[model samples]
Target: MVATADLYDERGEELASLPLQLRDLGGVAEFSGPVRTIRCFEDNALVKAVCATPGAGAVLVVDGGGSLRSALMGDLIAASAVENGWAGAIIHGAIRDSIAIGGLGLGVKALGTNPRKSAKAGAGVVDEPVEIGGVVFRPGATVWADRDGVLVER
Candidate 1:
C-alpha cells in the first residue's frame, strides 16, 4: 500500500504482457489485488454479492456499461466492501459517496463520481468478461492500480 513502485516492479517483471506506466490520476490512491470481473449495465446486485463475500485479496471490477448517469457503488456498498476486507473496487462507470468513499482506506477508481444512484432491478451478470477503457478484464486476472491508471495481467 505504501510502496506501490516496489510492488509494481515485482509484478511487472513477472508479467511482461502488462503495460507499465499507465495514465496517472494525479494523487489518486492505489489498491492492489486480483481481478474479479462483473459485466453489468446499471444493476449492482451481483456487485454487492461479490463484495460481500470475503475478498480474499481481490478487486471487484464492475463494468457498468460506461454510464455516467448513475453511480454503481456508493457509501453503503463501499462501507460493506471495506468491512468485508476487499482490496479495492474499479468501476467502469460512476460512483457516488465520493466524500465518504474517499475517506475510507480502500482503493477506488472509476471514470468519475456522480450523485445519482443506480437502480436495483438486478439486471447484470457475474464473473463475466468485461471491457473498460479499452481493456478486456476477465475474471481471475490480476489487476494492479495506482495513480498511474490500471494494469491487467492474466
Candidate 2:
C-alpha cells in the first residue's frame, strides 16, 4: 500500500475532506474489498454482526457520531473482523486496544484511542449510509485507504 504522503505526491493533491490525523496500525496489509456502512453511536453490536458475515474483501465504514466518550472498536471485535475475512475498518470514533489491533492483519483507522469500552445497549444500524470524516459512505461503495487518507469512488 502507498503511504498517504506518496499518494498525495502521485495524485498531485490531497482530498479536501477526511481525517488525516489517524494512526496507521501496522500488521494489516492493504486489502481490496466491497464497502459496508454502519451508522451508530458507541454501540458496535451491529458492526460486529456485519463483520461476522463472510466478507469478500469488504471494508466497514463505521459512523460512531464522532463520540470519544466510549470506544467503538476493541481488540475482540477487530479479531472477529479478521476472522470473518473483512478487509478493513474505518471508525469515526475512538478505538480501544490499539496495540492489539495493530498486531492483527487488518487495516484500521480511527480518530483517536480510548480505553473505555462501549455500552452494549444494542444501538446501531447496518447497511446504511454514514457520514463521517466529511464523507458520505454508502453501502457497496468503493473505499480505499492508505497513509494518504481515504478515497471513495462510486
TM-score of each: 0.82, 0.85
Candidate 1 has a TM-score of 0.82
Poorest stretch of ten by lDDT in candidate 1:
18-27
Q: Write the per-residue lDDT of candidate 2 for residues 1-154, one digit (tens) a residue.
A: 5554555566643332365466665356464456798888988778777777887789988888888898888888889888988889988888889899999988998888889978877788888887776667778876778766777653
**Model 1 lDDT tens row, 67-138:** 788888887788788888888888877888788888876788877877987788778888877777667788
Clashing pairs in 1: none
Please give me the total number of clashing residue pairs in predicted model 2.
Answer: 4
Q: Report backbone clashes per prediction.
A: 0, 4
